[model samples]
Target: MAIELKPTEALKLWHDVNLDLVRDGETDLTTRQMTILLTIYLDPPPHTVRGLAKKLAVTKPVITRALDTMGKAGLVTRRRDEADRRNVIIQRTVQGSLYLDRLSDLIIARAHALRP
Candidate 1:
């Protein structure tokens, strides 16, 4: 079944999900980091810093900085591609998958509880 919510309800769901993340005592990614994380997981692989920067319309340095933070959190790993050493490939982690799973649950729960 399709889900539907008013604009206020949608924002409320987002707020609640984000608030839960903040209180979860885990790695709370910044908005940029979250966007990058989602894009990486939602899209197909062979993710490169150059590709992400271009996709997000940002600079290579900006993507690098975000990756650095996420990398420290063990959410992602990067390595120089063997085929093309110039490209830094971004790989997913178990922790990152679990994090998004928890986030998905929170969003679903909040959406279900939205006021009619």
Candidate 2:
């Protein structure tokens, strides 16, 4: 027999995953920062604040604020593009990658363990 989750329950499960991520270590990622990180990882190349805002359907100022937080957290680095000085590109640092990797592993393992 299998359990059928209600739509509300399913939504809660989605929220739970993100909440668990927030509880990791002594720090938590703001939703915007997490979104930025995910977007960069999914895209073929890193993006500038303007590009990220467009991709996220947000205003450039919002993306800039999120980037500022992420930068302070050491999750990303911003640099001027060599080919275009006006472009500020964002890249995940090794620490950020490792944090994401561990979070993924823990979530996967927990899900597998939950399967009866």
Candidate 3:
């Protein structure tokens, strides 16, 4: 089902979710971290630091730092690219999937509540 929401409603929903995340004592991810997380989960595989940096219009160090932080949180994993040993491939973890799933559910619920 498709649910359309005004920009104000969408922002409000995001704000609500962010508040709940903070209240739950969850690590509040930075905007950059969340962008990387969502990109890794939603986009096609074979994600690399270079690719992410290019896609996000940031520097390699930026992506590396975000990945390092997310890796420590078990939200993402990095492995040697067998095809090219020089490359590090970013992979999604079950924990990250569950986190995104919960976030998605929260957003959907908020959207539903906003429906007239």
Candidate 4:
């Protein structure tokens, strides 16, 4: 017997689930920022702003802004691409890696708690 839920109900459920983490300060990242950060962190070092924009399906400006914010937050470092001096490459800092590790741990713990 499958159950159907209204769109609002589903959204509420998702909001509640997400809000719990925010309320507890488990994650400070906005959805878009987190997506961009994880996308770059998951891959090899030296991710370009353009490449990150493409990967995240967002505009280059969006990626640029996110990178700037992340940079200010000490979560990432941007360097001029050696091969292409005109382009910039983004890399995760030690702090960034630690943040990612913490996020993964929190998510895994939450998932485990939900299991029987």
lDDT leader:
3
Q: Which structure is stronger by TM-score: 1 or 2?
A: 1
Better of 1 and 3 by TM-score: 1
Comparing 2 and 4 by TM-score, which wins? 2
* Model 3 regions more than 4 Å off: 1-3
Cα deviation at 66, candidate 3, in Å, is 0.8
The worst-scoring run of ten residues by lDDT in candidate 1 lies at: 107-116
Q: Tell me the tens digit of each residue's lDDT in model 1 across 18-105.
A: 7888888776677878999999999999899989989989898989999999999899999889998888899999999998898888
* Global lDDT of each candidate: 0.88, 0.77, 0.91, 0.78
lDDT of 2 by residue, 1-107 (tens): 99676686666656666667667555577777788887877677758988898888889999888878878888888988999998998887887887788767766
TM-scores of the candidates in the order shown: 0.90, 0.79, 0.90, 0.78
TM-score of 2: 0.79
Model 2 CA deviation exceeding 4 Å by range: 1-9
Cα RMSDs, all models? 1.6, 3.6, 1.7, 4.5
Residue 90 displacement (Å), model 4: 0.3
Residue 50 lDDT in model 3?
A: 98
The candidate 3 region of ten consecutive residues with least summed lDDT is 107-116
lDDT of 2: 0.77
Instruction: Compare candidates 1 and 4 on TM-score and give the better one.
Output: 1
Candidate structures ordered by lDDT, highest first: 3, 1, 4, 2
